[model samples]
Target: MLFLLILFLGGPAVLTSGRVWPLYGTPRKTVTLSSYGGHVFQEEGVWNYSTMLLREDMDVLILGARETIFALDLNNITNKKAMVKWEVIPDTQEICSLKGKTKETECQNYIRILHKMSDGRMYVCGTNAFNPTCDYMSYTHGNLSLESKHLEGKGKCPFDPFQRSTSEFVDGELYSATTLNFLGSEPVMMRSLNDSIRTEFSRSWLSEPSFIGMKHVAEGQKNPEGDDDKIYLFFSEAGLEYDSYKKMDVSRVARVCKGDLGGQRTLQKKWTSFLKARLDCPVSQTKLPFLIQDVFLYCPGDWSTCVFYGVFTPQTDMLQYSAVCTYRIQDIRDVFSKSKFKAMDSSSSRWVTYNGDVPEPRPGACINNNARQKKFFKSLDLPDKTLQFVKDKLLMDQAVEPSSKEPLLVKKGAAFTSIVVASTTALDGSIHQVMFIGTASGSVLKAVNYDEETVITEEVQLFAHSVPVKILRLSTTMGQLYAGSDVAAVQMPLSSCDHYTSCMDCVLARDPFCGWDLISNSCVAINSIQPDTHSEVVQSLRDGKASRCPAVESSTTIKFFYPGNMVSLLCEPGSNLAQVQWHVNGHPVENSNVYQIQHNTLLILKASDSDTGHYNCTSVETIKGVDYMTQSATYELRLGDFMTDPSVQPLVQEHQNTLLALKVLVIILTLMLLALVAWNFYKGYFAIPKCFNSDEESQQKTSGCQKPLQTGGRNSAASKACSSNSNNNHNRLSGNQHNGDQVF
Candidate 1:
């Protein structure tokens, strides 16, 4: 009786099943990250390797591990590189521990610098038991050698093991931004080697800054009038303008001219052209400000068109949301060159703009041909008043804006840590910028800036567990992405063509790196072609329409299910973003109780004569308000009349006996309920009905509160009726045929 009641009312188990379905934003490919090239540190000892340098020329990745150095093979196909250790003395380690330092974790040497010099050598440095030191090193063909002598590394390297520091070499000078003290309180930007110059200690100069990245820009090449090159630094620090009770963090971009020589008298050995401005990336709906975490510079030979992409995250919100904002090189120039200065010593307490008359030749401007023509070419020749005014006035009044005045991409529940972009050319001779963003959840999202919006195409897992991605580098020539974490460094292909097998799947992916080849009838990379302009390849990135695929009929398969068994027809659509459509007898599915679409499978509750027909499945994609479809699978379902055969008598009789038992059980329960009601009435538990229809009571009908049972019997009045469904299914099913004879 319980089973029959559930079936008559449509059981919830059939309506809701424990199945996970593929939806939009699902990645087409998933592969675990692998680590290799470890002979010294082993697998379990590989820690503090979040920073690395890719030497593509040598086909190796230079790493700075804890008290050790290694060079892993490029592409990671075969691990072969140098593996060496650089440790401190036992007496030094004991002294470090006595001064309230950790012996196992913090007191050991941690190599933090692996900078490439103008000459073919590496300038390496390490925190030797809290006393930093530096030396010159050489690596070639799995061999390593360090200089016999080490030098003092005060401003070139940070005293702390994990302090945020960035350094690069330009014109044979090492320009570094790091701390100067053991406690990491003194932040400085200095250029060492060949007349070293450093920034003076002032609250207005740096203000508790945490530097992220620094890049050298070639500003002289784009100017018709001669000018010097520049070095731009991106960081986040406490806001100096906003008045709030809590700490407010804001992003900043500081710039210094490469040819900036120190001032003469008032500000000797100090940069005169050091200026910084605010970076704004605000989400309008949430009104949350995102702070910059990392920046990548893309300059394809010209400085004017160079663009900088930065990864940003919220200040204090617990959410894992992130945003990507872009700034053109030209827009940054306008803010620094045209905007007024924020006076460091204003009369009022608040930060005020300077409205006084500016000095001639622009005190904080790089020396150009115009300045030379006016007899003001060198920093040493500048006036004392001009140098003194620029000493404290380094902040600009205007803030730099993004290319579209908004974030290019805003993703929720994923904190982006690093980003790298590559310019790709499609088959239609159009260029698109593909960005590979690394998240804190150890995954990489592949997105493209199309028209004015961003579309995320694919997501690939680069690590087995949830770990933060500290470094991400793109190799356009090799077509791969190399990601780095504290314990692993893995390589992933930029284009995964093997996931898509059919033509429709290849086009629907909308990936610029992959396309469908009509000649071979398989998906392949765009670069695999000879000239890269093939007529057989098909790619619809703008619309993602799959109707362009040529018509090819799939082989028809005959399927027969027993009288009372569940049937499922699976449809194979390669992409998760596609919409699957199912039709029966060349018409749409009509009945809900019989047919259901779940997890790309068409399910039938109980197969019978009424469920027999020809079924077809196709994949549809929508783009720009138009639908494109291509056939993928087809099936013919037939229910054989097994009741007419003598061998099937036992099964049919068993099904009938179960139904009879349910009816008998329902009658017994009804009698017990009547006896209880009579006793309740005698004890005056409730009042009886006072009025009723006389004619209705005389005709003996079933009570309105009683539920009617549903049975699938051929002798029932509804089943024997000659309706439209019977006319359509009469021609396909035979009277006395069984499936066992036709198909095993």
Candidate 2:
């Protein structure tokens, strides 16, 4: 009876007035798939794959678990498809193996970075198993294994993956990001792609061990005629502190011409170099107090032109806050030619921080490079066109702020580990850059800017519970976006779910891990609560030792029907220690005449049309230590059903009115007929009796009848007289009949 009552009241159709359909159920299975590279992976350790990149032919480079590296193929995997195709421990295993190292079956060797070199070979870098090393391998199409001629060099491989380095192919030379430490130290702005080539021009202004960070700024950019002969390298020094950010310090942007990648071994003027001033960011500097972890350059459009974007944060805040910053490819290059360096005295140089550095023309610095050009100035690089250094700010805010127009804070923050940008065309036919930010909190937030501004036009939260996002990347084919945190690697198709309009913080506050789009509105998965129809044994026998649930007693999550939608509830399952009360905002969901409980579930039948708010499923549990109360996943309840568009609601009302009018008319007609019958019966019993024939008239009537029978002449005359009297009596009766008739 209890179950029946709950079902009757809280069924999706009943509660919602037949609006929304419930779409979530108990998760069938949560498998922590193998990490890219690991020794002994715990069942829960599948969340560790954080760094990712796409190789040629849809192969993915995944970095995780100490020195482990796995290349996976993501062509055929989804919630519905339960299969994975991957190649484990690429051919660099020989270089990763350490001699005399105590091996404990634990995955010790892990691949940190994978970079494709100029010679069509792959350079794989390990942070360090026993000792950090770079392994070089040549890749062949359709083959999974690395075809290496030999392990020619140990640690001298010129390609470094972790440092902020950019590479390009110029003439016959390759340039890359190189640094002092295995991870990073003093930075080498740019270098030849191959370790064997040592050119004179390569060692001059661009020569420095990569300690800070470096990347290719104008790679693949072509002149108007479309010749891609030249490339630009953006380099910065490391260990430099920011105005108010982190301990680590770095410059904004510098350039090394590929024309300088290969030259003579020794020369006064080796690699041609140009230095650009640092960008000015205002809002993020005050909020985020950390330094940048990395930078990535994106070529978002068909034109060879590019934009340099980086991830930044503050150093002090315990909870890391970060931002993403963007600059145009032309702005940095123009800075060098725009400003002239004033000579500094020896004593003045020691006192002045950037004494030798040049300044912009005038009104030089704007958050975005919107400063106007001066009427006249001298530029050594472009003498004809006066040099003017200007800054162009694209986006701001650690995550995309829905309202702010500043550039993203391209610095590291608490709970944040990695950032990557995916460039794609939106439904509007316009190009957009989707940024995936991984936080230390173990959650991933995807942000994209629309309206030609930096504010996050849309933000969606991924992951059920908070888990740090360690690394993220987009596929070359623009097919999918992959994210890696500490424990699991998640794959999201380019257009999988609806674009989330609300920010993650807003979703978290309401505890509605699920949302329905108000526009092309549909119920979407914000948590791991999926749509499963397998009808688990637990759904029947509530406490009969059925299959174990997928969630822990304190944080288990389930999806149930409420009104017009599937409400995902994160709560403790099966434990009935105390009153299990459901609340919206802070109001309790009480059991009254319409409230019901079933299988440890609460259902509200005839859910009020106005009860839309955040619903919380709260349960109090007392263990050995103390009493504790926990709330399930927050559900943001929006009124009405996506299935029942409001445009048709009025038609139903009109149909109902027509039926009511017909019923009222039938009742009125029946009452009138009953009254007429009662009146006729009263007249027959009272008024008609009063008009009964008198004794004389009765006698005359009888006599008339008898006279007609008499045969004699005397009786015939008497019969004639009686007939006249009888005729009078008959006339009176006919007259009375007219008066007594009742009209209906």
By lDDT, who's the top model here? 1
**Which residue pairs show collisions in model 1?**
none
Write the residue-wise lDDT of candidate 2 on 623-737 in tens digits. Answer: 2233334334455555555345343456677778989998999999999988888888878853433213566545544434543444669887876776787789889989888
Cα displacement (Å) at residue 312, model 1? 1.3
Against the hidden reference, what TM-scores do the models get?
0.76, 0.46
Q: How many steric overlaps are in each model, in order? A: 0, 84
Error of 2 at 670 (Å): 67
Clashes of 2: 84
- Indicate the residue-level lDDT of 30 in model 2: 18
The digit string of per-residue lDDT tens for model 1 on 622-739 reads 5557765644678888765575543366788998999999999999999999999999999999876532456544332323221113446753444335343455455445532455
The 10-residue segment with the lowest total lDDT in model 1: 11-20
